[model samples]
Target: MTGMERLSLRVSEMINHPIAQLRRSVTIHKLDTDGDREWEEVMGVLSETDELDMTINDDGTITLKWEMVADEYRQVEADEFEPEEEPVPF
Candidate 1:
């Protein structure tokens, strides 16, 4: 219940989060990158994450904002106590 919401956290802070470890893809927004080696080094850490897209931002900080329906909400796809078909007796 603590995940599935749009949140902005530092890369180090989210590295081991449950949501970050999920199989879902992630989008990184980096509006501007001044070509500073420092930011590149900072962003390089994202290599380990499942990043689907990325955009450089002026601020050298990881901005993670995502909402996954499967994680936010779940529904019972089948009837409760579904039983298998019975075989006819000879």
Candidate 2:
């Protein structure tokens, strides 16, 4: 599976109820170009800021971790809306 898909699946499985915060640990296939790129795409979808925890494992895989809080999710949603480029008749 692609890195983005794998991460999405894991996060989906992790959530069992409503949550105000969550910590996600995603494993990246560091040696594979496609896998690495997929993880980059996944990173764009997460709410993490300029900081995240990364670890290199003996098994050669890289682990990326970040936490998401309710406030961050709200900000992400708010940022998704843009004002109309032009005025419209209401």
Candidate 3:
């Protein structure tokens, strides 16, 4: 699986229980395009900045909140929207 997917899955597992206190420890490993391997270690408390919410407009536009900020976060323009694409099974 991709690094982003792995991190997301781990975080989801940690927060599955409503009253579960997430551990402050987490790590993500991946390889760069140039074939360099790297890892990131999370060592602090993670506070929720926003609640997860999504809105779908009648015109096929969508807005997702609380998406992690990282290099992998891609932005698609309005003109490039693909209506035929299948929705991800979140």
Task: Give all candidates' CA lDDT scores.
Answer: 0.45, 0.57, 0.38
**Evaluation by lDDT, superior candidate among 1 and 2:** 2
lDDT per residue, candidate 3, 67-89, as tens digits?
A: 43343234344446656778899
Whose TM-score is greatest here?
2
Q: State residue 31's C-alpha deviation in candidate 2, in Å.
A: 4.4
* Candidate 2 CA-lDDT value: 0.57
Clash totals, every prediction: 8, 0, 0
Sorted on TM-score, best first, the list reads 2, 1, 3
Q: Tell me the TM-score of each prediction against the true structure.
A: 0.27, 0.34, 0.25
User: Which candidate leads the pack in lDDT?
Assistant: 2
Give the better candidate number (2 or 3) by TM-score.
Answer: 2
Model 1 per-residue lDDT tens digits across residues 1-90: 212112224344454467664744333443343334544654665544453234445754445444455634443334444677899887
Return the number of clashes found in candidate 3.
0
RMSD of each: 10.5, 10.7, 18.2
TM-score of predicted model 1? 0.27
Instruction: Report lDDT (Cα) of residue 13, candidate 1.
Output: 45
